[model samples]
Target chain A: MIPPRRRLRRPPSAPWTRRRPLPDRVRRRLPLLLVGVAALALGALAFSGIGDGMVYYRTPTELAGHDAGPAGRLRVGGLVLPHSVRAEGDALRFRLSDGVGTVEVLHRGEVPPVFREGQGAVAEGVLGPGGVFRSDRLMVKHSDEYRAAEPAR
Target chain B: MPHRDTCPHSAVAALAASAALVTGLVLAPADAVQGEAQRLMYVHVPAAWTAYTAFTVTAVSGLAVLARRGTVWDRVGRAAAELGAGMTALAVALGMIWGRPVWGVWWTWDPRLVATLAMLLAFLTCLAVRRWHGDAARGARGAAVAGVAGFAMVPVTHFSVLWWRTLHQPPSVLRPPGDVPVDPPMLAALAAGVLAFTLLGCLVVARRVRALDAAAAAPAEHVSRAALGRAA
Candidate 1:
């Protein structure tokens, strides 16, 4: 008694179908993908230019033609000028040059004992009070290339 | 008394939201040191926590989609990743603004900070993979794999303080150390941040899932509409 079109009915939820099963290779590899995403993201962020505070070492020769601003904080890489390292109570003094423009640094902190003239060091801080570069921290520069130094403990 | 499905809103979610709100806004105390400036911590800590939670969810969902070969987990995974990333990005920006004035630096390569930034990038990559990969099934599977691999950063992020003596401090409010402890005021603020965002995360995920369903159903709907038009 009912028309064929009317009687040909599908269940409401049956309209949706589950397609092909995911390949076995993908199933086995999902964990690896997740882990990869986490690592790449972390590594890129760690070394990004987003934080401009940290710096790469540069020599006085490199800074010869450079302009040093009063409020700027950056690493000045150079050999400490001979006999230029001095300390007055709280302020420590040093000079760095790329053999062109020698910049004097006055730091208001304890100077590392190794901070002496002709030493390879980078002063990390701001320039202040008359073209004087003031450093809050200093790092000793060491080359990572392994050299054949005489065997010693 | 029974299921409240008849109501369009989720009562459980609503109640949870209310509780979280009280904790974030009223209970958390102002930092003895930073004072009002410390207020940023409420949203901050929560954003990071929620970001971690969201990424974890993606990993699980990615796995599910791969194993079951269905659209269910794929949709869930993408939704969680996007939402997680949105809040985490917000957290990093807020943290930077807070740090500039206090720490005198806009950013640092501190281990924990580095790890969190990495986590954000990983989530973005997963989303990118999903968008660009061509085949539906293959793309979902590929992204799923990436999601799982990306999770390796989780432990690294959490333990960054222990592993490195970086500038960033370890968990202070959450970790047990301060004599004052987290006062009720501070706790309340943190709770609110968590609640608001968790609900927000769920809300976004649900809406996304529904959208995916509608999009999936569109072809059939279109055919039906055409057929109906012909009949008329």
Candidate 2:
């Protein structure tokens, strides 16, 4: 049988202390409070940046009619006119129209397979003095519907 | 028998899953513009929605874990965070795949895309906190703190499409009041997909929590057995 004295010995663990490391109020709630404030601040910063950073999508008519200074690049979205799409080597030239007006786009890149005449597309670049929209990038946009209405031929 | 109670919604999830697949692939008419590539919406939207739901669960459970330290809360928080991270990764992948055929490029520095990617990384960092700590006791609290804090990314990700001009399209199904952006049938299908993914995510989290509970218990049992042997 184990000796009584030996059996009663404490295990090799840190001695139990009644004193708390910090007050109950400050100890439990402070970290969470700080985190919440920090998140709010960060959120405020992110939300504020959205206004000036946003690049609004525009159409040909809006682009031509806007008094907004040509501060930076903008996107013009519409359909490539039928028989207006032509490619010379890698350079592509097309006319995008939203029925009210059309813009000439000169792009040099591989177009999406879905990109074709009379399909919805967006061209991103600046409008030069000669009325040509020099686009470095082109994207095809589509309606979320399962079946979109046929484009007017 | 008790395990059966853990995930009571799996059957519903399976049903919804099948319905989504059928509606998305077979029943829905091919998109007049994108042809069949637009079918990716069925998967991408559902996965992203599920990720948002899972991360919210993670944040709530994280608060619980912080309020009252318990194995159940820890398990749930950890599992939800893991599932959220996985779903976010899959959503990003599906978006990229869809982008290639529709957008003509594999990727862009679009705000929404970048924000989603950042959110994914934040959750991953939460997971690493749970995994990399040398002491499991301390790690749980750290992970809970991180999980709760990381939730700030959710709103940012949700609003990124609207806040910036991106290569990505703006919200359609979840848009402000107007004519429904998608056809009625397509909306129904997308709803089915979201429901299926949410239920599936819940089922996955439940199983993971159960496994974590079992694992946590095993070590304690071993320590008790060793103590008992010493006493004997």
DockQ per candidate, 2 decimals: 0.05, 0.19
Tens digit of per-residue lDDT, candidate 1, span B5-124? 413445656776777655545555445444455667777777888888888999999889879867878988987888778877888898787665444455655666777777777787
- Give me the runs in candidate 2 sitting further than 4 Å from their true place: A1-90, A95-103, A116-120, A124-133, A144-153, B6-8, B220-232
lDDT of 2 by residue, A70-128 (tens): 65566778878999998867789999998998888898776788889977788877777
Worst 10 residues of 1 chain B by lDDT: B1-10
Clashing pairs in 2: none
Candidate 1's C-alpha runs over 4 A off are A1-153, B1-27, B173-180, B220-232
User: What fraction of the true interface does each of the listed models get right, in terms of native contacts kept?
Assistant: 0.06, 0.36
CA-RMSD of model 2 = 10.6
lDDT of 2 at A28: 41
Candidate 2 lDDT (Cα, 0 to 1) = 0.73
**Interface Cα RMSD for candidate 2?**
9.6
